[model samples]
Target: MRPRADAVLSEWFGPSDGRLLAVPMSLRGKVVGVLLALEGGPGLNVAMVQQLTYTVGLMLETLASRPNVPTPALTPPEVISGEPEVAVEAPPAVPEEAPRAVEEVSVAAVEAPPAVGDGSETVQLKMPIAPAPPAAVGRAPEDERKHEEARRFARLLVSEIRLYNEQAVQTGKLTRNIYSHLKEDIDRSREMYEQRVSAEVRADSNYFHDEMVRILADGDADALGV
Candidate 1:
């Protein structure tokens, strides 16, 4: 069949077989949408078309203007059935048993034993004892790290003091006046090392002092005196 132009879509997808028409669906004065019609035969009259458009537009406007209402917490679905609902009896609830009372024995009762009737035969009783908890072996991870850091700092500081004042250290060691010979270096290194290491480490431990004794005095702790 030869193509013919339809009034509604004449520009695009034009020359359609079926006659198309578009009428505005208006609410009050503003147009909401178009009510389209594709007619193959005699189309709807003006009155019917007007009624249909007005109904659709009114519904759209009402929905748009209406305030939102909160949905029910439990909105059960509508169950459609032709047959009537049959009454079903629920199962009886099971009765629960009452809890038993726990008996508490006093310290005196536990310590004191029941006297034997004859005292002729001796009976040995075994007591159930709970296993002891595991002992804590070593320092925690953080404490160990802190300790390691302190030791490193002490070692470095002591090494530096001995490094720069090698002559003084040697002379002091021989003369037994090590403290006097390397007093300045020793004091400065001690101060800096103590400052770097925390007071917690210093409270019980003398990592820096130990390092000075070990390194500066060549394992002769008394040589460095201070």
Candidate 2:
């Protein structure tokens, strides 16, 4: 069976050490995809594959039967075919010639500002600068460190949640229904992380959530490196 190129499982297993177990996830005799796991020992055999397949099948059947279940947007595999070979003759090469020399133009110096009453030029050099707020200016290093820790954890949380969602989709767990099971845990963790950071930064709890949403939109979960 061919897996989509953009699939996380495909990309992940594209490079491996050769010891792997792939169990086909099927429902109603229709093969959806495969659930890949690293081979552990003798326990990783046909029986294990069959059991996993049955479990995945049950999940798919139950979720598919649910009303208003959301469909996952997994990458679908495309068909690959061969193209006819066309032999083309090479074009004759042209002779190389010496390149022409380029002329350099000199730039004029910026003129001085108009002279003031004292006969001195009043050069008002405008710079792009903004004043730091009192809260930010007086923030302790420990507070900054805490805030950074919070941001990093927030990114990690988003990355892990996305990874979980993708895995659920692969195992036939539709998000609209299955995700509600994980929502409370994710929200509690998020609140705790936010509270810890807010204590240090002296800010409202909603600020961290806002920051996480911004990070999520920008796909800045690189901190997790997953």
Candidate 3:
């Protein structure tokens, strides 16, 4: 019988003084690769170990999905006997020659720009400009306001639903009536937000399409594409 893989890895790294961690690279219950990390300093915590293991597992899964370099498999002696063999030959040698001399040029002897307007007119020189760094995408005031509004709306809806549900329960209705009503209202609010966001996205997409068409009609395709 074959020994367990985890037991094998445990034995391999157990004797070493340095800290060792191994994460199995698996996808859909199939092992694809393995990630090994060794630390010489202080030991790692449980949370850090778990996080590193999960990250390495994800990386391995991603790598396994991509194209990789192909390697040839080894053949047995009986299979190799049927293949043809080629002899290796070394290339002929060549003699070395002396290097040629090169002439040096001086910057002071180079021609300068001609004088403008008999040295009376002054011309301004432009300096080289560097590119600006990209702006960060962060939560804006409008987004915060929207989030607050959404939360307020959700709380109000929850309270109203709960009140109606309590009244129904007091009148001798179902026992879990309050929970059911609250769940329904919460689900409804989530669905409503999803629909609103989808509609806004579609509107923005349509506006972009119209703007592109107008720009193309005005013969400014280069700026539009850029």
All models: lDDT?
Answer: 0.53, 0.40, 0.35
List the candidate numbers ranked by TM-score, top first.
Answer: 1, 2, 3
- Tens digits of per-residue lDDT, candidate 1, 120-223, equal 12112111121222342586877766675665566556656655666788888888678898778878888887778788878856777777776667677778
Provide the clash count, candidate 1.
Answer: 0
lDDT per residue (tens digit) for residues 52-107 in model 2:
44334334433333346344444534445557644554455444543332221111
lDDT of 3 at 50: 36
Q: List the residue pairs that clash in candidate 1.
A: none
Once superposed on the true structure, which residue ranges of model 1 sit more than 4 Å away at CA?
1-137
lDDT at 159 for candidate 3? Answer: 32
Residue range with the least summed lDDT across 10 consecutive positions in model 1: 103-112
Best candidate according to TM-score: 1
Q: Give TM-scores for every candidate, taking all chains together and pairing residue i with residue i.
A: 0.39, 0.29, 0.21
Residue-wise C-alpha lDDT for candidate 3, range 1-48, written one tens digit per residue = 011223654475554444444344344444444445555457634334
Of models 1 and 2, which has the larger TM-score?
1
Off by over 4 Å in 3: 1-15, 59-226
